[model samples]
Target chain A: MTTVGEVSRPSRVADPDEAISAEELQLAARNHGIPLEALRYDVTPAGLHYLLIHYDIPDVDPATHTLTVDGAVARPLALDLAALRERPRVTHRVTLECAGNGRALLHPRPVSQPWLVEAVGNAEWTGTPLAPLLREAGVAPEAVDVVFTGADHGVERGVEQDYQRALPVADALREEVLLAYEMNGAPLLPQHGAPLRLIVPGWYGMAHVKWLRGITVSTEEFTGYQNAVAYRLRRDADDPGEPVTRIEPRALVRPPGFPDFMSRTRMLRPGPCTVDGRAWSGHAPVMSVEVTTDGGANWAPAMLDAAGGDWSWRRWRFEWSPEPGRYVLGARATDASGRTQPVEQPWNRGGFANNLVQRVEVVVVAE
Target chain B: MTTVGEVSRPSRVADPDEAISAEELQLAARNHGIPLEALRYDVTPAGLHYLLIHYDIPDVDPATHTLTVDGAVARPLALDLAALRERPRVTHRVTLECAGNGRALLHPRPVSQPWLVEAVGNAEWTGTPLAPLLREAGVAPEAVDVVFTGADHGVERGVEQDYQRALPVADALREEVLLAYEMNGAPLLPQHGAPLRLIVPGWYGMAHVKWLRGITVSTEEFTGYQNAVAYRLRRDADDPGEPVTRIEPRALVRPPGFPDFMSRTRMLRPGPCTVDGRAWSGHAPVMSVEVTTDGGANWAPAMLDAAGGDWSWRRWRFEWSPEPGRYVLGARATDASGRTQPVEQPWNRGGFANNLVQRVEVVVVAE
Candidate 1:
């Protein structure tokens, strides 16, 4: 990507394929993970979005790539990118979540990619509604599950097969679900799963398969490793645990006025200050977000902008005049389904969806 | 520099000349500012040293590079690299300090470059003693200050000139002050002033002029722009301010064992854990270092490793068994001269030499 010439301001992600050497690629990975402080930016620039690949992000060429829909269908269809783009296209903003966003906060931290609150991002996706595509295929009555297969294949948890996950036929036919082709008005970057990917609005990233290859409507439930074993929030060995699906309601605060996060301690001028962030929930739309500057002693309502649509993250802002001293900045989000973030989320086996309140320590210097 | 192939392991710095375009150069400048977190590595490698160039680093050819000593010297001498290397050489480990190490922390934030605490580094410098060179040239009794000039030129504070600083003749004559030609056992890198640099141990980096061109023994007290207008701690407009010198006593703790810093918060296990860090003082050798995990309520002495030398930094370690919870880690250092780090350094107009206690916030997960 051609970045503007500033030679000082940093961007989030780089093309892994073009990176000079293995060391340069390594440096790119570290440098591109945009710190959540960049939340102040309205549309998290393309590559700067948080990355979480289940196994591999197999490269796909748009010219040769095609999507095959079969099994429990009256007509099997193999549609190429040109044909897919020709269908009625819809653009919608949605927030994609990793499901394991707060895994690092879990005590006795469970198995999974260790992520803080940064494993989430809001972006605009342009695609054809999956319900229309599934309707055109004419699903049979016996079909119970729709399994999505990605071209990216690897042995995860000893299962040597293409990465697969199944959605109950009912959720698969939801009008909000998308066969996404574009992100934030631009074609997807490779690290973000280029060519074709799913955009399961209101669901964690695992449900949104990248490098889409095949769609199989199954007669029986498909228990893939991702759905049945990995991504499960297990309480104990006996409990098979509930599969992680919908994104948990959560919010993260950035010190307002957009300061450079190069420093460990957030410094502020002791006067009129603002705290702002983004809040998202998959179960329902975010209703409200609250912020506390004095360690939860008193919370104040924050203004939230939801113009991006129901499934998209809302920008939250709060203004406060603070005195010169140290303060613990805290924020909690509540969703339309009445799910408010907890003070301390219970630790689970795989550390999925542990969205405790987000807190940041800030120091106010004399003005 | 050939870095060993560990694709995921992060390094502090990289060559800027090879970066793609000026944008990549800016990115390299930002990404290469080695995070303060890299201090976990003992003896920061040559290229990984923290860099803050005041002006463009002019390239100097080793074949033609020479140090010209004139002014009040009884006999002026211009010595080339080979001639200087013929003299007795010594390699010594010393910590270099930037006068603006904590400029960002200053209230009203007075400087253009808002440097945090990562502006310091320790390295092994190989060179002949400056005192002996001056002694051979026969220093005149009238010499008051030894002025050092570097080839780097720029317009700083609206003045266009090559960088320059001065040291009192007494301090310049100290045996430890080195006319360094090599760094960390290798010839100095271009960014590091290549042909030669002055190593004024126990003093801030302003005293260590890189790309050394000329050294003049001034009969009158030197009043250069760098010495008179910058690197001074001023409280108000009328205050001429005291020139900042000598690295202050300070210590930074790295988690006991090497732990990945990918987590937003430093992750540690419950039960016995060790934490270690580096400490140094300019006025004298670091006599003691203490750590406080309870936010300054209590202090515990830490074992220090200082066998390297008086001018070198001491590695300090502390063992603690912390209960599962959140903690604010703090460290302070004391020097043999009885100088101790303060809890809060008073604010200065120019934002120079802010050395307060260093604190790190960490999380302890249950095992």
Candidate 2:
């Protein structure tokens, strides 16, 4: 274990003018986001879903692997894969977005995973509700926070430990929260935390820990490295930032037509075209979605589909008759809570919770 | 369709000192490579498999999709997914690698997919042999090349067409060549060319067209864009270089210890450790593998496991005892065809067929 003061490489914002460093490129190559065109599918295919692995995927043998629940519980329990499957199963269609989805777009980019609005996916996860399991274990009255630990181990900012995070007792016992063992009707893929993982609905991906192995109920706040040093909305190095929770309002426009091999600029023959995308928010239901043809100078309301699920994204479409010229397309969403996607990015030291409007460049050509 | 003369964007090499451009970063985010740490598995899991899609994954409905085999064949046949699955089925453990696996590492890097040596995966493909299907269709005596076309359509360098590639008639009829519909005991995932795809063993990934929709046997040499223009080993724009075919010999060491969050420099305690990795070659079986503790200054032979399959990667392991220090670990493989991984990157205009030695940096700390 590394002390907080024995830092080797401290976090720092990257120079806006500099190109992506080799280290960022290395992370980008390992982790991937869904192609914008994949928005056509309601439930993202397993392989096309966005993925971010903090460390390595742990080698797990499912037959012998067991998850233990203890600490401040009247009855400690060790559950195997078969035991978890035998319980009442409930499936939910949920949308998960990384807290740092627009990190790279920040003027002074954060040096972690350099995501750009594509680090979000909607999936159908099947598992038993976590509330029932906690009830079966008979949680003690003094429990304030429940910490979930995963098998993936690594050194992040000089701290060597298994990945862990804690949720308040109220959030941990929500009916929608699950100990997910399956994804899209199939057993979890290795990269997706095979055997078991934690799924906290209406929260950023950081709250849903993968490769989950142990759960501990504590009386006090669990201030681990992840909860204390990472995933916080810090304004500067010295400021003790607030913990980042829940997904922010976001809308992404699928790039129209075909993409150029090198530049990825979209091209299409000028004519009647239907532009569509997906939008979601964790704080409240999305009320409206808007589209922009000439960047942000003008905006038009788009038709939103019926609510799919409380935690899932809603489809929005706009009809347009385009001309032969270059255009920058954009999309923004407003939730029932009055939270709206920002036209300009809200810069932070950790680049957390950035929901900047998406802008896609397209070229409409003469037929 | 775009004409050859109406060029929109021409190909060029990137400045050596320039950081990765936004365009390259966009492509990197869309397509992902397997993490080096995933080398521990003999057969890569579906989600962890390296993927490189040239264009959008076409919306494929398995029930309605039909594969047409036409052109110079004596009898034309349009087979649906059910008919193809009913034919004689065989499975092979084969390794597939992208031609531009080490593209980003080239001095003047190619501006396409900025891959950094992780664009390879070995999977078990279940499908019927293409030879029996061609024999049933009755191939024309004068047929010279077989062109396979995929539903993924996009523009590359000015030419717009479905992603297509051609193989010589002799190579197309090889017993190992398959019209695959399954990967790793499961039905193909959407991004992996659901319904059907071609599997050409011992060839670079470009030769194995995905989302396969049509097969046309022609009498003349097929000069398609993917074959004639892309995937070529050109030195300059004017040079009509040789076609890149087989996967070059290469070895990658599974990165040891834990990684730092931003820099990815690994750290571990000083002790004895066993370093292992996977190695393969499309032209021939890997005969020997060597490891170096001090960059490439010295090399020692590693123990190679018995061949797993004719076309699959073989495992190699090396045991080392080290004191506290910094080390640049390296691995290189030599194939039966006398092709060995080059210490220096062999530069090319397309950045194809680069099998440079793998280097990993690690720092040993006192316990």
Candidate 3:
């Protein structure tokens, strides 16, 4: 491990940019132009960071950094990163998407950080469940919200301060939600919220605070800038619809691409190809996924990766022999809660919670 | 140009996938560790495509394919691509944004082809103004809208049909709107609506029809699937907000990187950096751009490229020198209409018309 005073730390990454060339990415998704399929958990086990944050990747030394629990708690506790890690550890593969994952797909597209679907990823998070920590701190009965603050500070909207978010006491005490320090079986990257971060499975990425510093038990409702001003399902300039929470049912079919057409990539070659995708829902388990090549002309079931439990996206695959022609491919997902990916997603000004069907276009040529 | 068949198309590209290695993309944005600066459009003239469309890039022979003007026009006319091109050519640099450009950034993030800001592109289009053609066609006084039909066909939102869009007769007659035949001074690529496409300056990309095939002068309002069911600024499932028209005040900082992180790229070093970006407004000419390196604490005006007329994004730049630290950089734009990009944007069910100020975080380290 490189120390803070090292003359020159070997590049955190051999190549500072940790991205595969579009050509390589397309080659990886060469299954009948199924581009989303290129995002396989086996190949890319770490989850994608849907949001592009340009903050300092703080080099937090486990020896110095500490997580504090205060406010209405019976015992205000402060624990360093290592002491926190020594607690019971848990691991689960979870898929996390920024609430704004498909923000650019909105019609009057918002002017915020334009995010496409890449603002998401699935990963193995190993850390202590949040509930154990909360219980150990003896939450006061009157505490209604659990507020979290991160080490990264910035000026957002108009506020310049550390990133902060709040969860209801109930959610803060869930067994699945963790204070994760390890991602994909390794320590978290600085960009991924190193040393300590909160991983609220089933919630959007915003709820997962990186470089976590403190947890506050609030008797009154928490209204931090991130909680009150941002992340809302906005409607008009003045009307803030509601606070955004939970992931909606969604699926992605990765595909190969031709140069100049990353969005509309085609496999080029015709004939038989296996198509597959990943599906998930924060509200419930992804029950099933159906595929259609000719719009909705036909539907076919796909083989699925056995349940890795809730919060993680499920992998599904199908095979087809498509002839030389233009086709619109689609994937729809139904969750265990009886919620299926809608033909049309509900719209909001803040561009929140759009769980509509994903349609991809492809032109297959003769092999 | 190669014909329908030849020894080979030399492979439109060496590989179908055109993404750069993620590492390289990340490194390119390492200036002072500011990632968003990676979005550098000055280096790329033809902007980016943010839409997800699937259809064979038809190799239309201009000799065979024709543009027909019919419906509520006095003299119905049909003209081949060549005849259309011969009609007084005009060229202008304009920016095109998919109506759903920020859709992925919405709150509950839609599942439809997730589009972030990459759905926008600025290009020099050469074509004849639609107004002259309408005047020649003697548009009936009763005509309310001019409907445009593209030769391309695809299935969207479960509808299998050709791509189509319409403009109010008044809007259609605007000289800035054109029956474009070339982009960036060259015949559009097949995917970019080869042969002929409509270039509706200052309007969302949906207003520009690719593969121009038909222009119908309609006395009544036009309600095609693209207009009625899809592309509408929807509210709830039932509340179709309104037809999305006109480009709002928006600015983009072009950066380099992998396909996914197109909007955010950093400059890794902690030295002097010249930052530049493009701004546009369908509402009016871009008046000015303000940049801030110390968050919103201070704002400095960025030098802008003189107006090249309307519809195209204005170019702006700012130079700065910094020490080692983390910073949140921001860019906000103002238009001739006296409208400035908002700190937060109104949300629509379709995630439409979001023009929030953009903030980019960066980590500046010692050179």
Candidate 4:
């Protein structure tokens, strides 16, 4: 029931850097079509975006917290959280995307909450490598899978939403696989998954669990839904069939540089106006963004920010003109591999990969 | 600490049946070493044994009590409890055993409230065949699992316990698989898994889910703990080296015709008195139950019951002269397959398969 104007502009916007009040940010997130009440959303700023982890948060108290690393290993260990914190730590800026991001566009559109292209976010995370811990646990190279269990529980869609999905051992021991305890230089906020979380970079957000509790190193693949069901994508161009296990790198194409539409009010003549937007891809860095004002016939390149994180979305802006009438603005984003956003997205039972070129409508006034 | 007499004989017990008063039964059960308080026994009758289902009771309004059968079938159908009740009904006498019953017997004896062997009971159940519903649903012969989900949530050992377990389609569609609407030949009791429950005869209590909600037919096996972890048992003879799935049936043995010690007091003669005990096994019936007055050396065969459930224990008895002396009475139950209870149960990280020859100490009276 909220109008576009009401969404794009809120009465108050919280400054992300300023111990920003959550109350205002909540309203702003709502205005911008984001759900801040879903889980631990400690630092989910209004404009910066967010990620939705499919797993329930694990409850761990300081007194009873211990991480066990065993299975196909030379040694087994039970390390407490405090002991784990003593290990060398690393920090990295990365983006996590829920496989179901933009999934609302799929046909027969799944029976879950409809997402509106915002279940993706970038953050600087700090944690220790799970690889070293596995090494310490004496995990054999022959290990096949790593299972993560959280403290959260509930029944979702007739499924026992107990422990989350398990990842392949190869994925588990990745150097980038962090047993993260902090986000954006701050202790994890409860809503965004506090205490500890697992970060699997370059994969859908569902893989990175929030409020992580138990880590079981195993010798086989754990194919439960979050990994096997939720993060799935179409297999190939030929088969519009059922989705496969893996997800490919894809980007989102938004409107040109966060331009203000009100600026066009003073312009009497049909002249050039700056159009602004954002672009982000899960697998690779954004290479370029293109704009198509005359539908899909002709395309023009837009300027993009060069200093953005590889996982972070790139802001893009383009120059466009109106002829005293209605104008439809279109934008497409390309990744490093030359993979470009499609004009129309494929449909699936669960909406995923809905990266169709985005269009914004506007009206120009006559002088 | 409260005295044994005071703690054991609280005058508060709820009874659904008028056969025995609450006060008298509370004193009796306590005298027999049962902890009536820890059970959270809301309604405790002296004659009828207490029944405890693992999951929370589902609250079903008669107006919306419909059971829906869908997927991989000839017809997807929904039947209300009224319709199910009106259908041809059948009744069967069965005993339900919790997977963790006698769990305290495990070595290293996992840290749980030690059980005094009172977690087993038998009841008559009434309901319509689930097989007919499956047949109407057109269940494929190839269907491997029938998963039952319930509406109960509990926090056990810190894990959310919304219960779900899958049974082989062959096992699920059996003639005895009842969508039970009644327990003990009476209208279904709320606390005893009412509304509807799955009664899988011979399987552990985990297989009989309470608060039945939905059943899903699948061609794959469910790997949740209730299926994959809990209820699992290893044969004492099976090499400790192999990892297998099926659980061997076991049984409990109790002293026969107890409280008879006072009946023989009229003789006014005391030397060395002994009492006989009973034994039961889950698989292969009760081949033999031996009683030992001197630890477990001297053995004597105790009488066995004429009729026994496939997975039920047999009552046994032995006698000795009543003298002023203290003795440890031990009873070991052996299944037909030569599997005997060990002096101390095997050790497992997960407290499971705790079947040990029961040991109880008693003091003989002197005249």
Candidate 5:
């Protein structure tokens, strides 16, 4: 995997595996369960995506590693990275998102990871529960928030840069988050958030801090660049215009977009056909997903899997035999919060907050 | 720096100062400029904290490296790493929190990165904004969330993993979250989330995925494992009776509990002695913090800096000239939501959400 020093603008490597056939590259993306559209590009190709690290990548040899928690605590706790690993390990397949995953769409597009379409992906993370660590830390009652900082740095406001964010002490002690040292069944690649990345499943990617370094207990707020200026949302240029800081309940279209543009004439059987896809939301299990045959005009409720946690996508399918003609297939999702997909795309300068319904074009043929 | 594989159950590294000094580490955590806490065991040490990566870290070797954005849009965007470096750069500091920063604190703590307090950190991130990437991506009206996936992997539910998450299309395009390849005036390290880590300031840590592999333009949410489960607050705990799957807004206590053999006698002082400390909240900025000098008798308001974003921590200070003796110093914080710190701590099976008024005993030398 690549490291911070190794990462470059998309154009450099262009294609990491150009040696492989295009068809194979596409297949690889698919085999990796990536959206087919993601593989369409070649040189740092359009729509192709990658991930980012928010901190300095530290170099730790497995032999000498320790985790300690002290200060404002009952017992100054110390645990080696090995000891942490020795604890019972619990694993889960969750997603780590970049708060600006879709920021490129925003107008005056911010100067950052020039992500197009493939900025995000799914992974199974494994680690011990953080709760035990806090227990080991012997959290003091007065602690307000546990501030976590990373080893990465950059100048912010002309000052030496180091990033940090705080989680409520109560929340910090939760068991869901992990001091993850592995990703997708492998040791974290330096380029993909190597050892000790915070895996916060339900919130936006910002919540999943990478290049993790220090955790301090404090009774105040920690303000840094990424924590203050980025990943904010506005409510349609509406009244009061307050940014939504917390991860709003939202769902995603799985097998996102059109899948390699299935030839309408080829897959066309003048009989009832099944339109299938996946749906998922942050935090809550997906409640229901609606399918729109003709845009939003006619809506048919799609069958969905039993509600799953906000951690995974829910596969949904709708059976529909299209008449011999060209038509647009759209899907709208709704979570437990009743927040459904919007028909009209939100117009933002940066183009963030894109929760538009999924529209796919399909044609039917009569032999 | 430490890699995920390098992080053992218990870390072994000694305090900072070797690579990153402990005082500087403490400054990184305590400095109001970017209030961050040193998490981990101090092992994994401040300099060796784990790093997740995104967009391979691009030092460019200065002689090589290029970036380009092209896709199903109106414009084909391209830039070499040099061009990106040359492009106007905007710098800002904010907190990048892991959505699951407090996951370990959740009840029935879900299985994942069992990060205690070490999952989060603060840094002064500097890099080009992502807005240009969006412009390059040619975001369309149909686009929804911008998805991000990293190169890291682990097994969850018996499946190989890749870290993934999504940002609102708008946020993803913002220039604040940068394609940061540098850290504190240096190229990114392999473990420090090198190359380009999304600086989704103000959001949780998960949003800033590391070891970036790809970015995708989508009309729906990016529901990947790391993005899905890592960051979440269980707004619904159902009365300590039923098991909860989510985390709640919480706080951590430092110097947890009081020191043995010390009583109020050690706290009383003669004149003009200041009792100072800090306070913070997750997902909520500290609005006002209060100090109780008389064991809850008389409350004095602590000075607070202007509230920035919700992801960062607020620093507070209070001055009190003690009457010549030992006295207990108590401090509490309140957020914009009118949520104030509790006098007594809240109890949970996981020992999370332990935010309570902090009491510190200080001895004052009478003049």
Candidate 6:
């Protein structure tokens, strides 16, 4: 058993034959992904949204909790929930995907949250733009990074600390960045980070810190555990690895028909069926979505909905007519930058940013 | 691989040493349990409330949805959402627990949802009482059971059908029975059976059918799959087990102190601490809650809060000052009917109604 202090060692990939540890199961039970069927909704409901709380949700009293801006800022300001809400509010339909969305699918799984492909949600987040707040506080000219600290506290890989992450000054100053307090027009739910949380549109969920409490303008580069040690793509334990950022181009098909209780295998009648799904990319606008009914052997373009906001996912649909048989349905997306989802993602030590094409097995029975 | 028509065989208990199957992991990823920390709230928030969707969340259009009452009822009628909301309204805080909550904890686990102890939530359900509606429909005196059919349709063990369950006439007519359309003071989210659902206050969650659309008063007992085949306590494949019903007494402690990310083991400085949790029972009001620091060897009574409503859980707390060391904390509850939570629940084939005592591991370090 790995004790508290002993967990400081390098990340351990589970043995291929080993069963999921009780510890991983514990995390999976608490954090959940949006059910693939939920893709039917234009905006994911608050409760059905994918949630990844690194630690315990800090108890924040809305009346007393305040956001403190300090460090290299010219004017260190403390804003309460009411003050933040009084600012000009904007709502954006943004898609957020966890960096470890496909961690459990890796061959030697990185032993963390054990997520499959379901860890993604698109929601309308309402809040004041973060750039204006930073401008009001007057960021120092030499400030290289902005560090966001959340009230959630715990030990990650043996380091005892509050959850913290740093964003490059340019990214922090982006107009789309927000101090969101509402999700889907409702005050943020506790599990979704009530009081306040950061929303970095177009970035993976890790960049959007939850239960945010502090913003520190740092002259020096901020090297926090979350940004420095975790959420990195590495080949092995010894590699320093590149920092993971942005959502990779990926597409998922809402399982077309009803599912079997235990196996979740899709069972549908043989006929013409219109399959639809949502696709998104953080690097650039999703340029195209492709569907394949016979795995990846053949592909056809799917009609895309008129582009949604720059950060939200776009819906796409493909028409298919098939005879009664077993078929593996696959969907893949390509961004304007020409980045496309891979058929097989390379294995990484931390299991970060594995965006392989999704495949759903469907059995069309003869009616 | 189990295909569409091939799953009609007897239920299979997974090998004790086998890893969780892809199917079980798929289910776990889609459904979620309330984080134990959520126990802090009096009423579980809508999103944080545990959810278990047996199949797909039926895409319901509230504007067009209607509830039909027929069968042994003299006046067959269809009530639209507006008509149902025109009736007298009542709100109740009810605690619902899944029958398979501790299934994965069993030695030869049932190959289904694979839930731990977290599949329980207390929430406020608002709607009109059911007895009046039945009376308005003029149910015949010969009606022995009322059958509920939900919009959610799927195959369970090769049986393809809309989700359906039956309740005895007396239980269905209980004053507290409701046809709930709202949860936590808001319209039901799509995943939670938008538009309408049934709330059998004191019964297991299986009885509170989601996406409810029809009610049929039956002359004879309805031997539907859900009532006679599923959700039963069986000794083996051939054993005709007793039907699982109301919840058993159980207590859950909110994990204290901070947690290690991967292991979720508690790390707190040695000092005086208040260990608090919630306890409830459907058979009777919870009479006593006991706390233990050294596993289950020694036990002490905890203070209970003033009783909430009849179907809701009551809060309890225990104070302790312990020295620095590792200790396993345990909590158990006993109801007014003298039914206490078992230390180790007897294993059943379907893994229903297994309410074992909850044990949390904690490491109290010197400050």
Best by lDDT: 6
Local accuracy of candidate 2 as per-residue lDDT tens digits, A295-347: 88899999999988999999999998898877889999999999998887798
Give chain A TM for each model in order. 0.88, 0.97, 0.85, 0.74, 0.71, 0.97
In model 5 chain B, the worst 10-residue window by lDDT is B26-35
The residue pairs found clashing in candidate 2 are: none
Q: Least accurate stretch of 10 residues (summed lDDT) in model 3 chain A? A: A26-35
Per-residue lDDT of model 3, residues B295-319, tens digit only: 6778889989877556667778888
* Candidate with maximal DockQ: 6
Docking class of 1: incorrect
lDDT of 5 by residue, A1-367 (tens): 1122121111111132222122211111111112322222111211112344432234454456545565566777666667768987877666444444443333344333333223445566777877777777778778877777665554332223465666777777777878887765656655444556677766666667666666677766545544444444543323223332334333333322111110111123357666666565664667887887675788888998664344755667787766665566767777777676677655443244455564454444343
What TM-score should be assigned to candidate 1? 0.50
Residue A66, model 2, lDDT: 92
The collision pairs in model 1 are A7-B26, A8-B26, A12-A32, B256-B274
Better of 3 and 6 by lDDT: 6
Question: What is the per-residue lDDT of model 6 for residues B1-367, given as tens digits with 9 covering 90 to 100?
Answer: 3356763334689986887777788888888998999999889987888899988999989999999999999899999999999999999999999889888888888888989899999999999999999999998999999999999988888888899999999999999999999999999888778989999987899999899999999999988989989988899988878888899889999988888888788887777999899999999999999999888889999999998899999999999888878888989999999999888667899988889888898888654
Docking class of 3: incorrect
- Rank ordering of all candidates by DockQ, starting from the highest: 6, 2, 3, 1, 5, 4
Report the lDDT of model 3 for residue B123: 74
Best by TM-score: 6
lDDT of 6 at B300: 99
Fnat, model 2, is: 0.58
- Runs in model 6 with CA error above 4 Å? A1-3, A7-10, B1-3, B7-10
Measured with DockQ on alpha carbons, how good is candidate 3? 0.03
Query: Which is superior by lDDT, 1 or 4?
Result: 1
Give the distance in Å from residue B136's predicted Cα in candidate 4 to where it truly belongs. 82
Q: Write the per-residue lDDT of candidate 1 for residues B1-367, one digit (tens) a residue.
A: 0111111121112223232222222222332233444465456654346665665446577999989999998899999999989999998888876776655445555534445466667889999899999998888998899999998764354344588899999999999999989987878866677789999989988899999989999999888878987777777656888988888888877633212212223445578877888888889888899999977778999998754687777888898998767677878999888988777665777667778776665656543
Query: TM-scores for all candidates?
Result: 0.50, 0.97, 0.50, 0.41, 0.41, 0.98
**What 10-residue stretch in candidate 3 chain B is worst by lDDT?**
B1-10
Worst 10 residues of 4 chain A by lDDT: A258-267
